[model samples]
Target: MQDITLASAAEIAAAVSSGTVSARTAVSAALDKIARLDPRVNSFTDVVAGRALARAEALDAARGRGEPLGPLAGVPFAAKNLFDVAGLPTRAGARINRERPPSERDATLIARLEAAGAVLVGALNMGEYAYDFTGENVHDGDSHNPHALGHMTGGSSGGSGAALAAGLVPLTLGSDTNGSIRVPSAFCGCFGLKPTYGRLTRAGSFPFVGSLDHLGPMARCVADLALAYDAMQGPDPEDPAASPRPAEPALPGLETGIGGLRIAVAGGYFARGGDADAFAAVAKVARALGADGTVEIPEAARARAAAYLITSAEGATLHLDRLRTRASDFDPAVRDRLIAGAMVPATWVERAQRFRRWYRDAVLRLFESVDVILAPSTPCRAPLAGQKTFVLDGVELPVRANIGVFTQPISFIGLPVAAVPVRIDDGLPLGVQVIAAPWREATALRVARALERDGVAAAPAAILS
Candidate 1:
């Protein structure tokens, strides 16, 4: 039987639209799932069942009145804790903000989703201040990889990934800064897209690095992701960072084959020692896509290092005051990252920014010859929770920074990516990344849908699994 939890967002919308299922039914199933699994997974900081029910009832009433509705009408969703939700602290999983009062309005992204008729289920968990890569939020407790409860769930957006993977919700919002969104999606075996920086508006959400933070959808399939992405794109004057481009809908040209597309397989940093499962997954994608050629992102080592420096420095600057006086309040693991960012020299920060521009142009140059770039989302599947180190391609890595190798450089340049998961040999999840040029989320989604058609997307995760 087709699992109700595994149904794609599109299927749910159609069911609700046709009255085969009520919005209330969807919300009830999701809340029931959260209630049962969340205690073990810790994917949510709070599940607002009562509030969500009221909102769904209001939406159902409007539908009964024959009022027009948007594409996502009646769908249940969750926001990364960083996004403001009325009457919630937007604590962002940090002890630092625990005492802060409830918010006055929805973050722009949340507001947009609500306007489209998606109900806010509740706030998802995340790394404190969005700083760490592992899903262990010291303040909020570790969000287990429901895909493989023993393993980690990738960072920052870990809760979003976990909730979706554990069947708590079909759609959730997560941000990527140095790969937060994609990594979690990769490990959790779900589809996550980090639209080009600024392609989707960012106001009313908390900032991570400001330069690299990107908010987008995490879901079970590509078409549904495209639906959510279509709704989130476009400009809001309040966000100077949001691009002024018109919103691009997901319906156009989505199922086309990639026959003429030049898909490049990267060497160097991207091909190194992830687990055998990582390369195995990448191999499957290459075969399915009929990739045109292999290419190298030269100077990848330097690029990765520079990206780390830039992110650390900027992140520290963002929280300098808090760090100076309220240092003890931060998760000790991330406190060092903030401190390291603060200690870097001013000149290095500027130099990293200059290099960022140079790297962006170089990536653009690569795109001139290729339609998509393929790489492992993380070097490996989620690590054991609490461990801070791993070996990749034969080198030891600081667990926090190592996962970003493939994901960060692409995101640093404002590229849009679809983190598409593959099956795991050991019953965990594995994900590979598909990156397209700026403002090309549709292109990314199209290619991801192609992969799904080829059978590389995640299987239906069962409650028992």
Candidate 2:
């Protein structure tokens, strides 16, 4: 019974579909866990206890009547507050939208998941407007890491990250601008997939930086991530940014071996960073991948600079008018950064776009030599809860963007990355990243599976003293 609480959505669904466990039974168990554990961690902003039980009862009835069930039938899930669940206004962890009407319909992705029979648990919290990376939400309250109480969970998917890590839910939806999905996944010791740009529909999800915002799945294990992503990705006529291309399932290559694969370990900025633990996590994956050698993204430092410019400029432009009119409504932790983004020169944005073209080409060239690139997910385990000014190679950086040093450059190039947790044994969780070429999400999942099968990723804190 204790072990069942941590089962993946995939496992739970199979059990429920077979009638070994009913949806109501699963929801009841999960809700019990949330009640017991969440107060200690405060991972969720709200938990929909009544709504979930009702849905579970419906699924149990449908199954009893010999009705067809969806892929995620009866599995419990949640999304960041930025994603609109039906009848719930997308507050996005801010006060400005308090007067806004409740969301009339679920975000497309949320609707699809609900249709697939996954029960909605509640709306998780976030860094307001997805504006900050440190998960410090002055408006919504901070989401703490489940592994350690006083540490920050990476944001704006921070709530989903923390909740999933705490076993509150098996699957969660989180959006990424640069590293929102992967960073929190890294910090919280879970699996998060930042799908290719436009691979997953963004319709109905509140916009952060329209150009870069990507909604993705976060979960406790690789198989669960695949299940959620497979259900989410497809051509949605309503979403212009969603690919018109036909739906491609993510489950096909999950069990495939990584034979004859080209693997490279990244260093330079990726290697030398905040804590030695981060680099060690990357090294463990490199060794598992049979890495040939190192691949340096030349001028990576410049690439990171360019990414920040585009992020801030575009982010500021998106919130500029509202920010001006309702300055007091914004979260202070992220306000100055958003303002800075507004001030970046327009020419810098164009230059960054051109640099994106260059950087993508450089990454593609590297991919020609390697099937996957292994890198650190977060520089250090979530920096001691509320502390500011993390040290990276003895150089100080602001809390927000600094954690994304490796992730930003990769995201700027539109890469697909799988953040897989690695051992950090210091009472803090850590993860490593596996990046693959565009549309090569299969390759990334395969590498992640290999790591899991080979026992590289241990179960969280199996022997905590």
Candidate 3:
């Protein structure tokens, strides 16, 4: 049972589908592990034991009836708290959202995963309203890195990262506006995919940066990330931003390998502004893939700056009422930032949007030459929990604001990125971004699969007491 808890989503599904393991057993193992290990990790904000058990029993009954199960059969997964999990309030990691009524339905991604036979065990913790890069949440106690309890779990999908690293669940759903998803994956040592913006539906989740918000899966392996991404593909009428593109199943083409594909290392901005480990991780992955070419993304630094302005402006607009009525209810840091955002001049936001379009066009042109681009996922490894500052390039900077320095520009324009963990030494693991052109998730996943096959990138579960 304990072993089942640590198995990948693909492995558990195969076992359950073959009757070698019952769905109930798989879910129970996950529940028990969460109960035992989650206290220290603080990954879960809620544990839906009864709902999970009941769903598992139903899956078992379906198997008994000779009914075919979906690809993710019997897998236990969780979502960041911003995603609605029927009967629970969509916390969005904000103190004030706790007063809202319970959600009446699951988010689109959650429902899709359930349809694919993935059971949702609970809602995980996150940074307030998805604005944070560090995973610390003042409302809920900080989510500790499973590998080193005192270290930070990258946010705003911090809990999602911690849970996978701690083996609390094989998969989790998280939203990425800037670096919410990839940052955590890098810091916590896991595989995370931020699908092309609008590739997946955002219908039932709480809004952060509406234009920039993206929701995707995080897992310990590239296979699981592809599985979840394949299952959740499709357009949602309820979400106006949902892409109209048909489901491009990444799992089918995941192992096609990166043969005959032009892969390059991202130079210039991506190459600088981090500790040695960050670049080392990218270099290790580049070597594994035989990637000798490098491409300098034009104006990447400017893009990151523009992303911040847009995020602050949009986030402020979304929470203006809350900022007006419940300012004291927020994490003071988050509140103050949002307040500052409200004051951003309209001319600045307009200029940022105009630059965003130009930047997107310039970056997309690079994809014509290279099928995939590799870059560091985070500026550095996880910092100590509650630690306020870190020195990057010999200059001290606020940990929260700069943590997403590498991730923001990529996400600023909706590109698909697969963050694969690389552990080069005994120290904390780092990640390399396998970035592809819009709607080219398979290209990124294929590259990630190659790295995994070479054993250069892997997410080994943390051994927690």
Better of 2 and 3 by lDDT: 3
Inter-residue clash pairs, candidate 1: 133-155, 273-393
Candidate 2 residue lDDT tens string, 236-348: 87778778877778688788788888888886767766588888888888887788899887667888888788877887888899779988778775677888888788877
Candidate 1, residues 133-234, lDDT tens digits: the string is 888888889899886688899889999998888888889999998899999998888899999888888888888888888888998888878888888777
Which candidate, 1 or 3, would have the higher lDDT against the true structure?
3
TM-score of each: 0.97, 0.95, 0.99
Q: What is the C-alpha RMSD of each candidate to the true structure, in Å?
A: 1.5, 2.0, 0.9
Clash total of candidate 3 = 0
Worst 10 residues of 1 by lDDT: 456-465
The global Cα lDDT (0 to 1) of model 3 is 0.93
**After superposition, candidate 1 runs with Cα above 4 Å error:** 1-3, 424-426, 463-465
TM-score result, candidate 2: 0.95
Give candidate 3's TM-score: 0.99
Any runs in candidate 2 off by more than 4 Å, and if so which?
A: 1-3, 424-426, 459-465
Global lDDT of each model?
A: 0.84, 0.81, 0.93
Model 1 reaches what TM-score against the true structure? 0.97
Q: Which residue pairs in candidate 2 collide?
A: 150-385, 151-385, 312-341
**Candidate 2, poorest ten consecutive residues by summed lDDT:** 456-465
* Per-residue alpha-carbon lDDT of candidate 3 for residues 1-465, written as tens digits (9 for 90 to 100): 459988889999999998999999999989998999999999999999999999999999999999988999999999999999999999999899999999999999999999999999999999999989888999898999998999999999999999999988999999999989999999999999998999999999999899899999999999999999999999899999999989989898888888898989999999999999999999998888988589999999999999999999999999999999988999999999999999999999999999999999999999888899999999899999889999999999999999998999999999999999999899998988999999999889999988998899999955575
